[model samples]
Target: MAKIDKSKELDITIPEEFALRDEVRFLKSEDIKLFRLLRESMNKIEPAYVATYPPSECGIATFTKDVVTSVAKYTPFSKPIVVAVRREHEIEPYERIVRFQIYKEQRESYLEAARFLNNSHADIVSVQHEYGIYGGPDGEYILDFLEALEKPAVATLHTVLQNPSPNQKRIVQEIIRLCDVSIVMVRVGRQILLDVYGADPQKVTVIPHGVPNVHRVPAARVKRALGMADNAIISTFGLINRGKGIEYVIQAMPKIVERHPTAIYLVLGETHPGVRKYEGETYRNMLIELVAQLGMEKHVRFNNRFLSLDELVRYLCATDVYVTPYLNKDQITSGTLAYALGCGKAIVSTPYLYAEEVLADGRGLLVDFASPDSIADAIIRILDDPELKESLEAAAYRYGRRAAWFNVAVDYLGLFHRVLNRRRLAKELAESAQSTGKSASK
Candidate 1:
C-alpha cells in the first residue's frame, strides 16, 4: 500500500504495467475502462476540512478531528488536511494534520484558506459550521470563504434552530446555497433545514453524530474502580453553563436522594470556555450554593475539569443512569447525550430536539423542560424499575452500534465520493460543450 505523506501532495499514480494494460484494453471497451479509471482517481483524491481543531478546546473541533481520523483509518481516502479556525488571532499549537489556519475576524484569512484548498490536491472541502466559531454577525464571514472556494464544499451544521431570527435564518440559507451538500446529525435538523430555512430537501443528508465505540461493562465494576461502588451514580457531562440547567438538576436531586438515599449526581466537566470568560464560574458557584441550600451536598460531586476520553468513558461506564437537563428546547446536537446513549446507560433528559429524537421509541425517558419535579419523577421511575432500566440501556446500546464513529466515517466518505463524482461530471460536461462549440465554429 502506498502511504500518503502529510507534508506533500497526494500521489495518484497507478502502476505502469496496470496503466499500460488498461490503455491497450481501452480500444475495445473505452466507456467501461474510462468509468473504472475515473472511479479509481476519485478514490485517491484527498479531502480538506475547515474547522476549529484541537488543541482548540471546542466540541466541533474535537468532532472534526475524530471524523477525519476515523475516515482516514477506515476508508481509502488519503490523509485529510485541516484548515484550522483560530479565535481572534490567538494561535494554538496544532498537529501536522492542520495544514493552514484561518483567523476568525480576518477576511483575508478566509480568502487565503479558500485559495489554499483551491490550489492544493484537496478534491473537496468540508466546513464544520457553528455560528460562534466564525466571525461577523451570525458568522456570515464564512460566506467569503465559501464564495472563494472553487471546489465542491459540504457544510456540517452543528446548530439548527427551529425558529431562527432573520439574520440567523439568512446566514444558514446562504451557507446551504454555497455548499454542494448540507449535513445534519439528526432527522429533525434535516426537516428544520428544509421547512424553516427553505433549503432544498435533495441537498440535505442526515448522518447521526458519531459516538466512540464503547464495550459494555458492569456499572458495579467501574464504580468500584472510581470509589463509588456503593452509590447509585447519575451523571451529566459536558462544558457546564447556565444553559445546561444544572440548577434544576440540583433542585431535583433532593427528591432523588430522599428516595434512593445513596444516589449521587456526578456533575462532570469544566465550565464552558465562553461562559467562564464572560461569567467566571458564576453558574457553577450557583449550583454549589443550591446544593448546599437543599442540604444535598453529600449527594452531589463536581469534577471541574475537562476530561480525557478514557476518563469520560470510565465515568460513563460507572454511571447507573445518565441525565441531561438542558434548557434549550431547540438544541440540535449534544455530544454528551450521544456519548451517554452510546455507553448504554439508562438516561433521563428534558425533551430537547436531539434528545427527543434519540431517546424516543423507548430508548430512554424524556421529562419536561426546567421542571425539577418531572426530572425527579423520571429518575425515580428508572431507578425503581430494574426491568425498565435494563430495557432502556439495551435499546440505546443497539442504536449506538449504528452511530459508532467508524460507521459514521463510512457515511461521510460515501457523501464525499458522491460530491466528487458530481463535480467531475459537471466539469467534464462543460469541457465537452466547449470542445464541441470550437469544432463546429472551425
Candidate 2:
C-alpha cells in the first residue's frame, strides 16, 4: 500500500494504451466481485474541494476551509485536498493541503485545474461557487473547468438570485447541468433554481449553512471579561460594505440608547476588500459621520478587522442582541446570522429571504428594510422583554444545533457518496455495453 501525501499534488497519470488495456481486463474479470469491492471501499477515497481557501480573505474561502476540515474530522476521509482560487494581486502563503492555485483572471488556469482533478485520486470534486470568485463575464470561466473535468462534481451555491439577467440565468443553468448535484443553503434558493433557472428539481439539495459548534455562554461573563460589563451590547459582524445597511443600525442606536442608557452597538469586521478597493472607505466614513451627527459616539464602536472564529464567538456570546440591517432583501444566506443563532443570541434583522425563513416560528424578530424606527423598536422590544429574549435565544439555539458544522458535514458527505455512486453506475453501464458490442462483432 502507498501512503498518500495530501500536501502534494497527486501524480495519477495513465498511459493511453495502459488505460485501454486495463479497461478490457476489468471487463473480463469477475465483474460482480469487483463492483462489490469497489462499493465497499468507496469510503476510503477522499474527495477534493475547489474554492477560495484561507490565505484568501473571502467568506466563501473561510467557509470552504471549515466545511472541508469538519467533514474530514467526522468521516473516513482524512486528508481533504484544496484547489485554491486566487486573485491576480493577492499572493499569500497557503497551507500544504492546498494542492493547486487557480488564478482568477487566467483562462488557462481553469483548464489546468480540470486536468489536475481528472488526474488526481479524488473520488469526486466539490466546488464552492460564487460569481465573483471566478473569471470572465458572469464567472462563465468556471464552465470551462467544469466542462473539462471527467470526475463528478457537487457545487454549493452561495448566492441564488430571485430574478437574474439572461446571462446570469444561463451561467447558473450551465453550472447546474455540469455538476452531479447543486447544493443551496435555503429552500428559497432551491425554488429559484427550479422555477427561474429551470434546473432539474431532483438535482437540487438544500443544506443549511454550517455554523461553529459553540456552546451557549452567559452574556454577562463574556461582556465583563471584554470590559463591556456596564454596557448592553448589540452587535453585527461580517465583511462590511454599503449593502450591510449599518448606517441604519447606527441611526437606530440613538433611540436604543435613550431607552437603555448603557446600550452600545459594536460593529465588528473589516470593510470588504472589493468595496475598499473602489470606494476607499467612502461608505465607512459616511457611517462614522452618521454616528457623530446623531450624537451616538458613546453608543457605537467599530472594530475594523477580520475576526477569527474564536474572537467572533466571544463577541456573539457577549452580545445582548444581534442585528443585521442588510439592504438586500434577496439575500439567501448569511453566515454571521447563522453564527449568532448557533451562539443563541437574540436577533433583530431586516426581512431578507434568509431571515424571514430562519426567524420564522419565533426564532428572532424582523424589521422592515431601511427603516431605522423599525430597527430601534425591535431592539427595544427584545431588551425590554426578558422572557421574549430568552425564548428567542432558546429557539435559535435549538435550530442552530441542527446547522452545526458536524451535522452539515455529514449531509455533504452523504451527497458526495450519492454523486460517486451515480458516476460508478454510469461507468459500469457503459463498460457493459462496450463488452456486449465486442461479443456481437466476434
lDDT of each: 0.87, 0.87
Clashing pairs in 1: none
What lDDT, from 0 to 1, does candidate 1 have? 0.87
Name the regions of candidate 2 deviating beyond 4 angstroms: 1-42, 433-442
Q: For residues 1-442, could you state the per-residue lDDT of candidate 1 as single tens digits?
A: 1243344332222112333334434644667776566556645658899999999887998899988877876433366799999986576989998999999888899999999999998888999999999988888889999999998999999999988899999999999999999999999999999899999998999999999888677787766666676899999999998899888888999889989999999999999888899999888999999999899989999999989887898889889889999999999999999999888889999999999999999999999999999999999999999999999999999888799887898899899999988988998999999999999999
Q: What's model 1's TM-score?
A: 0.89
The candidate 2 region of ten consecutive residues with least summed lDDT is 9-18
Query: Model 1: runs farther than 4 Å from truth?
Result: 1-42, 75-77, 437-442
User: In model 1, what lDDT does residue 256 have?
Assistant: 90
User: Candidate 2 residues 17-134, lDDT tens each?
Assistant: 3332244346446586765555465466578999999977879999999898778765432467899989877776999989999999999999999999899888889998888999
Model 2 residue 399 distance off true place after TM-score fit, in angstroms: 0.7
